[model samples]
Target: MLPDTLDITAIRADFPILSREVNGHPFVYLDSGATSQKPRQVLDAERAFVENFTSAVHRGAHTVAGEATELFEDARARIARFVGVGADEIVWTSNATEGINLIAYGMSNASLGRGGQAAERFRLGAGDEIVVTEAEHHANLVPWQELAARTGATLRVIGLEDDGRLRLDEAAAIIGPRTKVVAFAHVSNVLGTVNPVSSLVDLAHAAGALVVLDACQSAPHLALNLGALDVDFAVFSGHKMLGPTGVGVLYGRAELLNALPPFLTGGSMITTVTLTETEYLPAPARFEAGTQRVSQAIGLAAAVDYLDAVGLGAIEAHEEALGGRLLDGLGAIPGVRVLGPTHGAERVGLASFVVDGIHSHDVGQFLDDRGIAVRVGHHCAQPVHRRFGVTATTRISTYLYNTADEVDAAVQAVADSRAFFGVDR
Candidate 1:
């Protein structure tokens, strides 16, 4: 469902990068799935924080330290509200990749008898299983594989159907008594498939397994409520959500987070330290070791505010409509094969496709030559492409800043690339 209307011109003006020209053509950025172009407001926020409140947080008692601490935690509170979680539930991470690793390593610690009885449920052993999907990004998949390697647990996978949807039947059979964790993507970065979270949640819960969501894609595009989803843990990157690159969010159910062991240990994450032994702090702080990403957090908060001001529903509507245009236009081009979700299916704001008789890099170069920025290659989800029987693809992704005209231009570029490479011949 889209809003009544959106002013594409006015929305595009907020982002300074849209005005950029490439190869003598006006820039048409279609790679938001890889990294979104930042708005001036977010950039200014980062600059303002560094220029003004450049002190370390949670350490000093001085005025500057207090100011920095307040701003940092305030950013957490703001970002927490945007995703419908409590501030304490959100732990700062270097990026979503790190966030997922935190959970996996924390659980590994539990398996090794680190967190005592509090983390017993997180432990996995010989016959135990950790389940993922064929549609997961490597961030969500690889860490679990490493965790399984560390703990002697078996790794199980839910297969994907022909249309790129997860096989719930396979999920029912694969996730059973031994399954200790079930992690999957809220939306496939490659497929644009909005997964049926509730059904998966029910299955995991019924099996007494913890559910971890890779929400790096969903957090920016959808109105997220981690608490409402009842997920045990979730991870999303700030950069993907219109924020800074060095910061990401790891959201855990408060109780679970408190019981979990810290992944990276250092300065501020401890409650008490001695030569003999050390006691760690609780949740957010427990996980946020060392000096925090103060300036980056503030910039992310500003991005959150900007997104809120634009209204997620409106953004969703805008992206959905543009996604429709992307799919329709790309589908119309000869030799272009959309990798996921067929025509008229519900999709988010991205598309990945392959053109017959042309390498994906050649297709990307042709598009790049026309000033359309797209993501080419495996997109960090090799399993998904392998599931679709392709090694790589050309991906066009959208955000609120994108327009239908740009989508058309990208489609035209794809068509032109096909002709230029003689793909249609």
Candidate 2:
């Protein structure tokens, strides 16, 4: 039931991998929540750069270097605009994990008096608390844990409800004056539940704490405006959003980024080098140390351009329909328990579920035999699985290119798996 505005056939054609078969059956990729398939446009973009304008950005003073720098910065500007931010606010990292690590390490360095007086706001003492949620991916959770360990700051978690939504009531109580930072996911990778960003932002800001959003899941599926969201910082990966791997984005307010000390410092980020101390550059450059992800950044720009051409609004609408189908079909199966919101609640086009008497690995293998690819296990958010009283679950995540038939096929396969495992009863 895709919307009239979206053409599933034409869109699927853009991704070459979708046309391939597995186990002599039409390949049905339902693991977009883990990583999305790349389109030819993005591939071509990266290839075009590597073949022609491959050069060190902002280092060499030659024609190729100048063009490469322009293209790299232009990619930043385009990606920044895609998420409703200025070019200066975007900092490139290896991946979303690295982006979060950059912020954590930067804050840790600031606490250690690295950035001096300008970084005072980011400094945390022993009594200060860093709050995250039970729904956070390990990428978001582990860094804060390390940051807390390094700074002697306590790490707190906002719990989840029975249906996997964040406990906002508990959040309000937990995010008190002692909270220095509140980090959470925009969308839960396991549950596909969209968290209350505005409400959380209000709570964090009210307590005079900085907010960091993990936008890895939301950036690919929803229409995003980081500036309008008002979170102090955010991070997303290119690979999750139809772009190449080896490149990710960290968006911070210009003033905050400027004030924050550099996490990784070396060549391309320094102003002047003395025998004793080295002066650093400004916001984006200060954070992007070493050689840049020149071609990958260009590919990411092309990814955003493809998304723009197709329209995020239409994509959201299409996924909503697919989500309903998944919820309805999967929920109707015997011995199957779908996690997250119940039938009518809003969520992205993804579901993580456990089948009674069936191991998640078995279920995943069962689905794979039928040419359906899905994500299994804890999905890197162990606490969410622990919250649901399960150690593992199978997940199917959808995107713009997925269609009603693919979701239906996946649903049927799950039901078939229960019978295969002698758990149909």
Candidate 3:
């Protein structure tokens, strides 16, 4: 059973934004899938770093620089443990988009004979296949698309089933000898459908392909152990996990990262630079070029610490209960069609829906007027919306702080939206 201290009222108190009123109504933040509101601890961490020990890391020999470097690397180590990987395996990127691009660019370098043995492992050529799913966010999809274009490899995609789950039956036949890399999400950001990752990983490995998991949605809500999952690479953004923006984590097996060449080259990522030749730094340092987001990293480490204190398992259970409430309440509303699984069994707290005879933009605006925030549009997964026969959707995503009362408010707003727009039965 889940712990009783995960009470929503108490959890809500941790977030200051939840107390603020929007047009006299208490703010109901359901847009956590887009970006979560930070708790006081995370905010203070960032401020403390900027105020007390503001200095460039890994460069200066002075006291402040040494302190800053220690704090920065400590943050890296914390994030590494948070995702179940070695500290050296964690590459700090601007965001998950940059992280995915780093992998894609590394593969491109390998194809061009730039990377050594590591490059050979990732090299793609004619007849080699890279597999993705129709449900991928554009960050995951477009990078592979561009990689295929650059490497002269074929890009294949796993289609979704009628219920919006990734169709692994086709994947069995599609992932074959020519397949080089298999990339997909642990959970669909739009559909909220959790994929069978272990089974898919097995299939990909059996076919001699590497797996890259987009864990932007799952890492924030679920208990993720990348080492146990055994994927070659995994990427997630810090902002969605209650940390500041401009920071993200890319976890790769140490050997693979050590073998792959750096994506961005500059000051910090070099071992030695002669006038004529430059030798790069190893692993994480090689990937993290230029001035790192020092304070953001510190804040992200604090965010991980906060989540660990609350317990990810407890958070998941709380979200599942809220997901059940959301599914039931939204299902009963007229002119409302909830996408993905209508039940809570195979889902999390995120729900996407469409209203008959009313545009999603109108629905979003109506809900906002009632102090409810939801994501509306293609949600960066255009192909997924296309599969569901819609151009856009209104999505309500919950977090650890969300309550059953807020879920009810969201459902009521949806009903009110349809009625106000004259789409109600």
Q: Please report the candidate that would top lDDT against the real structure.
A: 2
The per-prediction tally of clashing pairs is 0, 0, 0
Each prediction's whole-model lDDT (CA)? 0.91, 0.94, 0.91
lDDT for each residue of candidate 1 in 1-425, tens digit (9 for 90 to 100): 34455777787888898998999999999999998989889999999999998998999999999999999999999988998889999999999999999999999999999999999999889999999999999999999999999999999999998988888998999988899999999999999999999999999999999999999999899999998999999999989988999999999999999999889999998989999989999888999888888899999999999989888888898899888878888878777889878666667989999999888988899989988999999999999999888999999999998877788998988888867876667
**Which window of ten consecutive residues has the lowest lDDT sum in model 1?**
1-10
Off by over 4 Å in 3: 1-5
- Please, what are the lDDT tens digits per residue for candidate 3 over residues 107-175? 888899887765688898989999999999999999999999998999999998878887778999899
> Which has the better TM-score: candidate 2, or candidate 3?
2
Error of 3 at 383 (Å): 0.2
> Residue pairs in steric clash, candidate 2?
none
Error of 3 at 47 (Å): 0.6
Model 1 steric clash pairs? none
What is the TM-score of candidate 1?
Answer: 0.98
How much does each candidate deviate from the true structure in C-alpha RMSD?
Answer: 1.3, 0.8, 1.4
Instruction: Give candidate 1's error at residue 283 in angstroms.
Output: 1.2
